[model samples]
Target: MNYDHWGRFLAQKVNEHTGLDILKWKNEKKHTWEALSWPDFYDKVNKTALALLDLGVKSGDNVAIWAENMPQWLVADMAVFSIRAVTVPLYANSPEVQAEYILHETESRIVFVGENEQYTKINAIREKLPSLKQVIVFAEPESPEEPDMSFETFVSAGSFANKAEELEKRRRDASMEDLATIIYTSGTTGVPKGVMLTHANFAETLRTHEILLDMNPGDTSIAFLPMSHIFERGWIYMCLNRGMTIYFNHDPREIQTTLAEVRPTFMCTVPRFWEKVYGAVNENINNGPAIKKKIFNWALKVGDSYYMNHKRVKKEPGVMLKLQHAVANAIVYSKVKKKAGLENAKFFPCAGAAIAPEVATFFHRMGIHLMIGYGLSETTATVTVNRYYDFNLASIGKAMPDLEVKVGENNEIMVKGKTVMKGYYKKPIETAEVFDGEWFKTGDAGYFGEDGNLVMTERIKELYKTATGKYVAPNYIEAKLAMDKYIEQIAVFGDRKKYIIALIAPSVQAIKEYAQKMNIAYDNLEELLSHSGIISFFEDRLQKIQREFARFEQIKKFKLLPYPFTVETGELTSTLKLRRKIIFEKYKELIEGMYVD
Candidate 1:
């Protein structure tokens, strides 16, 4: 079915199968579940679409949405799709400069701003957006100072019944080939380019998800990742189509607490969140008395043995393996899963980047099905995923049904499927270079294992040649560094150097513990990062990490960056992928300092 049909189909399912409790926002202390049914959802979408149309939004016009994860954002998105308009979702935390570029490039006619912060951002660059005609804010207007219309005002201006009929009529004509979204690549090198995605692109991805994961109507999902990302966007639609109720996360800071309260059956997250959980667990173990620490360590060893012997190898467990696993799960693994708020989670999909194998194994040992997958935004967010039944911890899994995946001469992954993007918007030459006749060059280097699982090595473009003609894949080195509980972020550099070097960002919790143990006093993050003793500590840690790597891939020199890379900064993309080019340019001075004798 087409993308338009997917939305209508989901809406029909929600109306038939679900009661009023299809979607909820319990975090706000507002019980909105009973009041908002599928009919209500569809009505709002239709009215909102008509409101946008009334504001002169055309069928192909770009309508940008800058908001946190909220019900209104979903409504706005569906409304855009209803009229065959393209939705351009900007990261809520994006800088005004970056947001301005997206808005201007897409030539968005209407922008739905979440609250005051979002409105202020658009207002700052309103003059620069020639095609931007109206600003519809989701928050209630408190005073005359606010320069936007509230969501209530925007919807109230249109006839709900009339708009619903009008949109339903248009929906019948909306084709699978119609452009659904224009997601701007986070622009690691130059200005972000819009990647055009058709309705069929997303629909095909959702179908693949259904095959890989046994998604059903009874399952529930917690939306945590930014909806602006194609990963979450596709997943959200997948849930909607399958008749699953979605709980929108109101505050990311309280995600753990919220997860415990909601107890969702499914979730999607990046590796960093799991890494932080691992860091916390390790820190607690380190702080505990000797006996407790020893027991915890023993339990982990037992758990690892059980996973390797049984799950990884798919062998029948011997008597001793069974005994050890039972003891470990009861004593340690079960407790760990509970603390991580994943006891109720069936299978959590890990994407956006390569998960450290150790962490993946650790979670699997603890009975958490951490399904790791690999894809780019251009691939409609998913290309390969480990099936729930036949998952392998070491592999990213086999290609999805209907997707053609092959490794090139240099082991670069290439994909051809209905889900593959149309091309980069308005840049035919650039698009032509990347998108071959049918297959899209993933730029990611990987190989298909004997078992037919896709194992990603590194990005072909990210690989750098050293002065000695040795090729270094930074991701491989960085993944090893990430296995360290204290190391949060590490970037390797050796483009024209004799030896490799790195910039490290230590975990905040790890740094705090180090400061406490050493009796080092600090006023803030800046002072702690600049401390000579702390720097030496990281140096020693890096040396230890280097020992685990080959000679060429070892990091020879390094510096500790004061702050971690964030989406707010231009260093990282919306999907939490590093923009290496931007980072190298931004930190040229500090990077050069490491090379000087």
Candidate 2:
């Protein structure tokens, strides 16, 4: 792989698949899907590249993409890469201050915004940034403000300039040493730091995945996760490389609708998505008639035996068991799969946080390929992923071929590979701190199981140490409790304390239904949560979920809130990881009250 991984190979791929549909996007106004053939997509990329050239965006200059998941987002990214410029991706929903910080820090001369909201945000903060000069909005804004223009207008401007030769020269000049992208961390701990990844890093990642995963040119993928996130961004790169047809899912709230329509062969998503599906499926079965529950449970057992015992073990199922599996698939699994539009699902890469083993197992039992893996932005997305066969449900699969992964001091997962990021952009001290010799220290605590599978323990900085010197992994506890239908969002706290405590946000609808069924009356949710019977019910549920946990690790007290932790409330990161510090400070009183007893 050379520095021309994107400029050469990607361009070649587009040319090779010129007649094929490369991108699909839903038109919000028309309520129909629009597609772009490889040639059409390539034309846009070329025009966008020439546009950047016209804007005086030279090689090595930083260009910011503050947008959501959309085809234009990739077009702009590819354009930037083709010209060997560094791309700084800000979360589509990033606050003005954060976006301003990234633009200012990178000294970005131009930025591509997704829509009006992003344009407005950047436009409002333009005065604060000395270097930011142009704003390119992906959508046609009602009014094109000064220093900003519609994406179409920007693209059209390149057509008259005749800078096509310059764009080509820059593309040919692309090198592996060129800085590719500067992805800002979600900053669950604090201020976001830009993780600098080079073209070489992406090239190696693409190669490694091609070897480890089963993917083909005609495969279909739905881009549901925000492309600003490395998991999706990197995965999409591989999809393009493999000539996979990608459907851009614009609004995440409508992912289920898009999922059913696309019925994609592959996708990348977070654990929260699966958690919701698992909860919904379980709720329906639990609330249904006894006979239905019994039938569903029986089908699940049959699936487990056939898939886990026979198929997974490479042993043929006996005739009787095969007959049972066929009945289960027809009567239960097939219906569930079709309802969720997972009937065509080949494999889905799940990561970003720990998914409950039970949830992963549920998908596996239903003949769904849910490949659980682990990695970080600094590692270019995936370091380990479960294979199509011979995978351990409890572990985060095997390391990618040729990627060095090992447990380091403090049980931190360490990596030394081509996929590891070059360093944080313009932050030498921070970059130096995350590396020891050649290994990039992944600030996660984990160890390998006896079967050579990586078993993640907890995030090193997030591990809670009790006053009694007991260590508690809150993620393990929270992941388990979150599976309960009532517990929508939970954060465990007990650092230097007697025992663990949790702040829970109950599922409002589920709680309301429970109240109706139990004959508990309440004027409002807050009042309902304060009821003695509700507290006891939650306590009973918590005890049952934590029965396997050590006594010290069990949550001693909990406070249920009527509200959920939201990204807008500063309690969760853009990626939905809990910001423990802010959450603790926000509810200091409630946490203190829990400690009073």
Candidate 3:
């Protein structure tokens, strides 16, 4: 229960308590699940930490970890924290320049490279990293060439007995005030600022959830999201504290299949995945024969009606409602949930951005307990999360217990609590600007509903003023546009222009289907995207959604991109958030062409 005692806490679970499984993973050979009885887990962590200490990695020194969601990454993370060294996680998908920026900013002494690609990235920028001393590559001897020492060699160099002694010494010196990790924010600004999270900061946040959610050691978690984000970091630590088993996903592409195999009790995800599930279901229904499509449509209507009226009034559903609801659940919803690998899902929390209220309602209607939370990295992860018992479709639930949240004079959500970070790392002026007295300004505009639930409107910084002096929130418009299955990514422009325009990326799968229906042949994706008929189809849909927005906020002109924004392209953040400035700069010419006379 004492989250501050992370070192002793994990050690106790590993040594004394042996019933609970700790971590699980699958490889080419077989699936492996390690219980608390496994001394190998503890041994690797201790030896790794001791090896770092032997290599001159000291308390307060930053240890950079560049890896995907693998067991070694978790081991390195725990070891770094155990040694009282600050852990800095670099997104595995990060560009070489971004990786260099993080390394230089963190002043990391030793780096842990996941594999060949990570090693290659570091090698490209190693010369520019003044503080970096050594790179410990995690791969087999047969693996591709890498920098410095191999992980096995580094651990082998340290005596296990000596490592145990060093771990004890580090634990004795560790305190609540010591910096735990520096999670860099994935922002549009070229320079990523590290959010310094102290041991007490994460400890209190995890403990708050532990009490609120009743998390236990018997619980299991499937971690797919990159651990570089504070959301996953906090969740992983919470799992560790509770002695829950964590299954590291092997193939991200096979997430659904992996979930079916693991059957994890709980997980967290962004709303985009949920949207994809919805789109897939819709596609299946559309592809079916006339009778099946009609049946599917009827079932959806029944489900929607039941969801809308369930708690309010017990209407004896007419024969139609009864028959339609049964058929829908049996044929559509059941198969959809099964395919989503949520057959045994206990709790699912959706965050990072606002989900469509209809999407939230749809899942809830299907007996899915999906809770929505709202927060940013500066808040250390979660400020407000919808409680399981007191759920609402339109609201982002109430604030977490012990956290203070209020709307500022300008409608910005300001929060002050143990969960808040220790200001931005090394940016005193910028930090002071956002911090008002005691509360940390969220920079998001929102208000509390009558039910005391937080209702987020838009980002204060993202709001744009039109030529007519009207303020418009692009996110609201963008969310509406994204609800159309054909639309993948849209950035609503027109900050000071006459009206809003947009940069849109259509879903390739959806576009290809449209092409097939129209009998328009295409050789490849590029030709498909360039087809005028396909572009016009999207334009019509854009106009239809434009009616829902205010006149000033309507997207007037738009440009369709050939490809969707991705992490590799440096257009989207690791969390799948758009880098507005980067996108605008990258497509400057295209954007100008849209407004040309």
Query: What are the per-model C-alpha RMSD values against the true structure?
Result: 2.6, 1.6, 3.1
Misplaced by over 4 Å in model 1 are 1-4, 26-35, 141-147, 160-165, 305-308, 311-324, 522-527
The TM-score values for the models, in the order shown, are 0.93, 0.97, 0.92
Error of 1 at 442 (Å): 0.9
Q: Mark the regions of model 2 whose C-alpha exceeds 4 Å error after superposition.
A: 1-3, 212-214
Candidate no. 1 TM-score:
0.93
Name the better of 1 and 2 by TM-score: 2
TM-score rank order: 2, 1, 3
lDDT for 11 (candidate 3): 80
For model 3, state the Cα shift of residue 87 in Å. Answer: 0.3
Q: Which tens-of-lDDT digit does each residue in 137-238 have in candidate 2?
A: 998876777867888899896473578788778877878888999999988887889999998899898878876455777889999998999999999988
Indicate the worst ten consecutive residues by lDDT in candidate 1.
26-35
Per residue, candidate 1 scores C-alpha lDDT tens digits across 1-597 of 343454355566656655544566653556433235677787777788788766766677898989998888898999888887899999888889999988888888788888888877787798898987778888874452444689988899657454556666667787888898998887866788899998888777766676745666767788899899888888888778777778888668879977877777888888888877876787788989999899888887777777655666676778987898888888888788787677788888889887877778777767778878888889998889887555777889988888899987688799998888999988998899886678799888888888899999888888889999999989778877886877888888899788898888887887898799999999988899889998888778788867867788888788777789887777887666678887898899999888888
- Which candidate has the top score in TM-score? 2
> Which stretches of model 3 miss by more than 4 angstroms?
15-17, 29-38, 141-147, 211-214, 289-332
| TM-score, prediction 2 | 0.97
* Residue pairs clashing, model 2: 3-175, 3-176
Q: Between prediction 2 and prediction 3, which has the larger lDDT?
A: 2
Could you arrange the candidates by lDDT from highest to lowest? 2, 1, 3
